[model samples]
Target: MYGRGGWARRIERRLAWSDSFVIVVVMVGAHAARFGWDPLAAVAGPSATPYWQVSVSVAVLWALQLGWARSREPRVLGHGPKEFQRVLIASWRTFAIVAIVGFLTQWQISRGYLLFALPLGAVVLVVYRAAWRKLIHAQRDRGDLLAQVLVAGPARTSEQMIRRLQRNRRAGYNVIGACVPGGSRARKTPLLEGVRVAGSLEDTAEVAMSLGAEYVLLSGSDAMSLREARQLGWELEGTGIGLIVAPALVDVAGPRVSMTPVEGLPLIHVEAPQFTGSQRVAKEIFDRASALAFLFVGGIPMLVIAAAIRLSSPGPALFRQVRVGRDHQLFTMYKFRSMYVDAEERLALLAGQSDGNGVLFKMHDDPRVTRIGRVLRRFSLDELPQLLNVLKGDMSMVGPRPPLPREVEQWDERVSRRQLVKPGVTGLWQVSGRSDLSWDEAVRLDLYYTENWSLASDAVIVLRTLGAIFFGRGAY
Candidate 1:
């Protein structure tokens, strides 16, 4: 019922207000800390510009930089890394400009003030943006604050797009209708379960208008020619409807894509994925060092867990299993035993009752789990010992899930891509849905991570894993 432009404007206004508030807080706090309550008097500086004047100027400049940077634009709003990156760039540019001006004009700005304010303001702005994004995600989850879209493409492509949009609700797209190659005759056969067939490609604009669509998404298989696509764009020019062409590339991040115009045609160039470099070496060192630090920090609790497991079950406190690591190498992965001594013996009887994906056996309430073991598994205490595996260089702090030897043995060419990176104590699969995910979904996420691994993304997954563990959402 809400207009897309109106919703976007509302979010933009809120962001603007929050940005101004953060800027004011950072500037005023820095001023007060450096120069105390006196506004008229300048601290020991060559220039005698009033502290209040300087604060006001800095705040206004910061807000202007944010606006000029298009940080609040709808395209980068709600989700993706672009929003944060823009905010950071804007903040750094503002500071750099101020530094240059101060240097040239011989205006003595307090070094302590600049140092304290710049980093504090940037961090506060990013935090505020993240909080706002969380609120937007919650609204989108409830089917609010989403852009209505009409999918125009072949039946297969439309269906795939709908499924993908459904999977990522935070992307803020609500598919309202579909316009395939066929006309109304194809309406009898729905493209997606809820998405209605509006009309053919020729009637896309009309269909989008009727459905109040903000955007028309053209999938890869859409039969519209270049001229026809251009005509469609022209028709929607005055209607405030945007056209988007969905490329065939899957699991490609924006950073790896570039657009170049050649002979009046926009050509998309995708960079090949890189796994080995200085970054990989740094990641390897980081994984082992962090693991060593965690082991030292959690040593006492691990010992207590081991003692509890030994007392609860007859088997050894620690459980060692063969797992496939990077390059298909085999390694002994350790975990605090969270199952009874006879758990393996009883697996055959419960195999048919597995409540997990076909490839991974899991149960919400398994009889093999001891009382103490259940507590340990619930909070992921069982995974604490994997820090040792990470320290031993056989695993990482974040990567694809460490697969059992049996699972690796059954891997096809597609699933084998996970072996390109070292197994991890936590990963996209762990934070996403864990035991609740289907085999294909799990594999898809793992491959996505494997293909587009970055230190920033790894840090994000590690943080989300903590939240998932605390909430105990999809854990067995």
Candidate 2:
């Protein structure tokens, strides 16, 4: 297969060049025909002012603005709002320059011409981009526009990179094969299905060239020397191929990755994960403001839930459990009781029937779950009390998963690091797969968040959490 990104970049450059030419010609023609040329001739007679010069200047400036805004950046071409933003920026910058020139020279610029030209150019640009994006998206829908990437790294890292690319197709990567730097001892050419081992890391560049790969994705901690890697970049520099570096750090959220150039080396600094701090302060402020507003708004529903629980079961409406929080502090986490009062007492009998992963106990259909409790858990009404906990600073709107002391005690050294920040009512695990996640996977996600938290990441998690709660996947 062809290398990843090669085809995509080629298409982007072709479209950009063609579109740029068209936009420039149309802008120049529109402005001169609509306003400048006739008026300049009317004022200057046959002597003629330099109208063509001004028109050419405007066209050139428009083109330069497009380039400056990187309206043609391959990575952002077919998705997100960045592409549109760039187009708008380019058009507005060109318009501003025109306005400035008219003011400075005291030129009789027609208001109708300026108004019509700006909007028309913007509309044409957006239309062309939208059409091109649609075409590219259609190609992706048919799995035709993908760039076949060659992943070079150790066996495991290569495998992980391949899987990650396969999972996120919108990123436009297609992992065709892998090259293990040290070479694998396996007799088979490929350790995984559909992935052939092209060569060792020492020959990574050669493999990429031979395969006509569009992109080279690098992984591994020690496969290639820095000198060899630099040489590989130099070899691929003019080859129209792209190089991507994938670090060994797994599950790192994007905002946490920051590059600081210390001397000549680009050192990556990962910030510690905390949902509170400034983000928490902001969240808390929102939560308190919201909770107070919601208590009045949601008070009726809260009362209804309480009444339903009281009438359905012969017990209190709320249940509080001892949960570990930030700094390993113990707090009583309140929730609408979803299990009978004797659920904990009955845990000993259900030991053999435990459905949870070793440490955490769960049963898909527990005998202790009250009828009303089942409904409460299904829609996550049980979590509403935690909003109060959030208001009180005992929990957050988003963070790592809160763990029980027993579960915390069973954690290995790395897992215990989750306590470095406050726990959340809803977190990465809650939004990811919830009860469906294995203990290991859940711990991994929570720790991943604990090690790389951000307000934006928290917002994304909370947004996803809302969807998960609505879908009720793995919630029971």
Candidate 3:
């Protein structure tokens, strides 16, 4: 019943305006920072063009490039790293193009100006985008600005799609109805409770248009052939609606997927995720280096935590426990002791009263936790000692959380795949929900991280970990 992205367009317009303002300010600020806001001060060279003029060009070009890059696409607007990636890509390419043009023309562009503007602008733009995303997510949580969707598939798959979409409201897909392959009995009947089948597969386009759905998903489209699918697309030509085919693959990251046209037919290919070679080497190097950096910064705070632990509890400040690492290797994990000296010995007696995720042991207000231990674990200060574990080559800065040997013993074959990479002090599981997530959900997140490992995603997880630590939710 709503126009396509009317609310989205409102947000996009605000973003475009903000993008211009940010670019302009950064460009002028860079020039001012470099040349001291002097009216007559040109660039670095004598008889060079005024940096003020150059700033204008860069600002306009950068904003234009962002638009051309489709960084404001509604689908990528409120969620995922794609929106940020596009913004960064567009900004980088804009400067790259500017550099090339200046070089070809033998123009004296101020390196200092660019050095300041490029990084600053990129960071600011992304930060602003993140702010916008937060706002969008807040609205989505309130059931605002969602794209109305109608799933067209078999009854089972349509229900599946509806449920998944409903689960992730942050992605902004609101499935209002569906078009399943039925002899009209399933029609006017509840597909999955409140979500009913609007019509049959053949009526997908008309139904989507009638319902004013923004998206029509052809999930499990076994009833439709290639020609019929195309015809459906043709039918929705001027309706301002989009058609998407829900590929059979799930939990696969974008980098591993590609569509190859074989004789006019699109064939999707999924590459197996590699955990070895250059990527692995790079990850290891980054882990150790960052761990060292963190330890340097956190040294004093860690000492204070350790001292507090010693004062609060009779146990030694630093606690070393055995944990499983890469390839099922046993490693001594480090932590600031947050529990009493006899906590482990008292575990069996308190086992049955465990308020854990079934597989793990966690108590919100555990008697074993000392006074200072609550503060330490709440902000993850207890885990800071694991930086040494990382540097000792026993762990990574980002990976599946190191599991207890006993916990590992109970895992299934799929869960055991976590051993393919080194464990981390913090991970997708911890960031998602520390002690509150179900065992199955936690394993699913770990496996997802294992299969879709990337430096970018790892950085994102680490950032999210900071927020999780600050909030202290589900972190007993």
TM-scores for the candidates: 0.89, 0.66, 0.93
Candidate 1's displacement at residue 126, Å, is 3.0
TM-score of structure candidate 2: 0.66
Alpha-carbon runs more than 4 Å astray in model 1 = 1-5, 31-44, 48-52, 105-115, 292-317, 372-376
Q: Cα deviation of 74 in candidate 1 (Å)?
A: 3.2
lDDT of 2 by residue, 1-476 (tens): 23244665688668768766777667666767675546343322233345555556777788788888988877777664567778888999999988886776667666665676676878788767867876786787678778768888778878877875675565667677788855544323865777888777777777787887888888774778788778888888877778888866777755677989887667888765545467656766765676677567888899899999999988899999999998899999999988889999999999999888888888899999999899899888898888888788888778787889988888888899888877887888897678888888788888887877766667557656766788797888
Off by over 4 Å in 3: 1-5, 352-355
Tens-digit per-residue lDDT, 367-434, candidate 3: 98888888888888889989999999999999998999999889889899988988988898888777
What lDDT does candidate 2 reach at residue 421?
Answer: 78
Clashing pairs in 1: none
Model 1, poorest ten-residue lDDT window?
A: 41-50
lDDT of 1 by residue, 1-476 (tens): 23465988888888899899989989989988888878785634465577688788889999999999999987677766678878888999989988897877677888899887887889888878877877897898999888899988887888898998988878888898889887578874667778778898889999899889999998864487788887888999989888888988888774568999998778889887777999899999989888888889999989999998888778899999898999999999999999987888999999999998888999999999999988888888899999989988999999999998888778899899899999899998998888889898999999998988888788767766876898786877
The order of the candidates by TM-score, greatest first, is: 3, 1, 2
